[model samples]
Target: MNSLTHSSTSVVRKASRFLLTSRRFCDTSRINGDEETLKITWETSEMDCGFAEEHEKISVRRTFLESTKLSASQVLDTLKQDCPGFNTKLALDELNVPISGLLVREVLLGILRRLSFDNKTRCAKLAYKFFVWCGGQESFRHTANCYHLLMKIFAECGEYKAMCRLVDEMIKDGYPTTARTFNLLICTCGEAGLAREVVEQFIKSKTFNYRPFKHSYNAILHSLLGVKHYKLIEWVYEQMLEDGFSPDLLSYNVVMFASFRLGKTDKLYRLLDEMVKDGFSPDLHTYNILLHHLATGNKPLAALNLLNHMREVGVEPSVIHFTTLIDGLSRAGKLEACKYFMDEMVKAGCTPDVVCYTVVITGYISGGELEKAEEMFREMTVKGQLPNVFTYNSMIRGFCMAGKFKEARLLLKEMESRGCNPNFVVYSTLVNNLRNAGKLLEAHEVVKDMVEKGHYVHLISKFKKYTRS
Candidate 1:
């Protein structure tokens, strides 16, 4: 066969192989509900590939250069003016601006970015119309970035079905569905609080041959973890196993954290054992997860023993491991255990960072041991660990809780002098506490200071209402 014919045959063979594999997976997998979607995806892929091959044969002019009189900003403004309503198709038909390839990409991206901030459903509708209009242009082809931007806009507007349709359109256009694409979809869906939907989409993506990562299941799990959808993580992990995908280290760590967060302690230990049997040694993250679980479960001795086990396994605990243990202990009200681990962390040749010190300080403050909290604050400062905003906020809050308004005000100034700018939380802490303590005058002064410093000026009206009431 000729080279072109051979290449075409090879592509067909590959597509056929993909179809066969997908069928096998569908037949054996519990995702039988997606059988129709998988069939449609395969048929669409075959059709798109055939169309692409034919188009390549006939299309000789790949690049189009047109002199557009309008700038990108001008086109954007025109679209914004004409396409602000839901009748985007009518507005697009009326749009007479000349568009180049560069102009279309730039305008589409700009429009999406602007609309992302606005997050209006109308904006999504208008943007989609513009996207369709651009795709219809002879000189303009939708780039992956354009699709991604539009997808993100749709996601922000809570138009998830529209977003998934864009993915389908991308696939039909023969665009490589990359890891970035999958991650974007997962993250946006997670941000929309559609954790279960994220999993469903992931499974559907797999059926449609949208394999972005080498281990796509782990990628979805990791993204779910980013949004703290622990319950979904557990569910997805279980689905991953049922589909015969082996759990990697990342998978184990993610599921372990999910199990820990969900209080499935029995399942957590079982997975730990399974991990060892599977010949995967617990890394630092695994150790930290166990440390957190043990400390939070009020098993201080077990936590210490796990730290020893980590060292025995040649995985030396870092400051983060110690901090996790300490934070868990603090939450469990094991203040003395927190202190002991803080010391042990230093002796293990891992110097405590600011986070380590902050956790301990926050712990003491929460325990109502203001003296110990103050001592930690001073100790961290003296030991050259300059307090961060969180550290200062913890101290300021402790003072406010103890009704030491004067000292709290001094600490606020001290933080600024020490080159730490108080954040919204710091200012809010003072204002809310002072107002609650009936120190309306003091709270008003703080509000004025916050406004003068260009921090949360919008809160001024709310503070006024609080004071008046």
Candidate 2:
């Protein structure tokens, strides 16, 4: 409400103007890596959990690899072997059996991460029956985490009816439907590809008698934001208040983050004002979200200005704040400013991490300053900041763009040597460059390598099918 706050409002509002181009977020790379590639799912959000940041294609594929050591069924079998009478004890009523609930449940859940999709589907029934039996015992109490694991399996299998039955049982057994339960369930909605249907199913549960806790509604709202379901996020938030749960600090942060995500600056300011009125102060995370939005909006000056206000308000600025400013400056063609902040960041006693280096490198590449990008990349390795796949991919793309195919090829091998696999983006860039340069044989070889690495290469597939026809 003072001069500092008034100026801050102008900074954010002006920065928000760039949100028109903000969805692409000042980087071509930020948009779905291979923009031409077909998507497999029908969900509106690009995120699986809707809230977690998207990983590279290589990392995503690695997540689907079946464990060579323990299949999901084998893991379940081992559970039965390890606890010989566990299920039997669970089935028996009026028996007080001391069970390591989390231990058993986590073991099963861990296997799901490793199991093939078919195996995961097969393991679902086994998991459901196990939980149903476990919940039946007087001594076999399932934790909220345990409920989430089962719900995840059910959501994955599209066994919505089973999930409904399980929730009903959960309520009847006095299991508290806290935020954790709803957070997991809402995340499952994204990961399981349920979209908005789970929201309806959750509301439908009201017919069964017990009400979901305030935290449950909060989780749903946050999860909606994770998927960029902007309108639904507000819809759920209002429903939460109408259902009588006053907005807590967490609730305000969720709505505020979603507001920035959709560039709804008016809504964001209102939420901030309302939070203060409700006796809830914005925390470090609230400021971080603001910093991120400001930076992404290409307002490096405003984002840096925000750190001054952060100091004024007694919230210490973090490495994330500095890195964000560096990224913004880099995108704005102010490489000198990026260096200035990188130096200023250390002067503030917060060390620059690998992510900081990567952002700067990306900016350099985008601006055609390949030499500086390479210099920073080497400095990162020398300083023991392990470069991730994104770091490597950026340099590779830069090399390909600059007609430095030899450098790109070497960097691809270097990344693999460091255990960072080249993703489809890297290969696609190389292949396109090679084809353009009339290196047909090399281009075809790279395409083959791409398909071997699990790219569908749908265009090539269509070509082959056409020839066959």
Q: Write the per-residue lDDT of candidate 2 for residues 1-469, one digit (tens) a residue.
A: 3654566668655323322555543564565845525443534355565545445555654643433223334445544433334553333322322334744465557645644545655567667655665666565677867876787777677676667577666777777565455555566555566646767666545432224425566657765676677767877788878878898887888888888878898888778778877777668777777777766665656677777767766778889878877776777677888888898898989988999999999999999999999999999899899999789888988888888988888887788788887766667667777777877777776667656667644445432212211
Tens-place lDDT per residue, model 1, 255-323, is 989999999977876787777767777677877787788788777766776676566556778889999
Q: Rate the local accuracy (lDDT) of all candidates.
A: 0.76, 0.68
What's the true lDDT of residue 25 in model 1? 38
lDDT of prediction 1: 0.76
The window of 10 residues in a row where model 2 has the poorest summed lDDT is 460-469
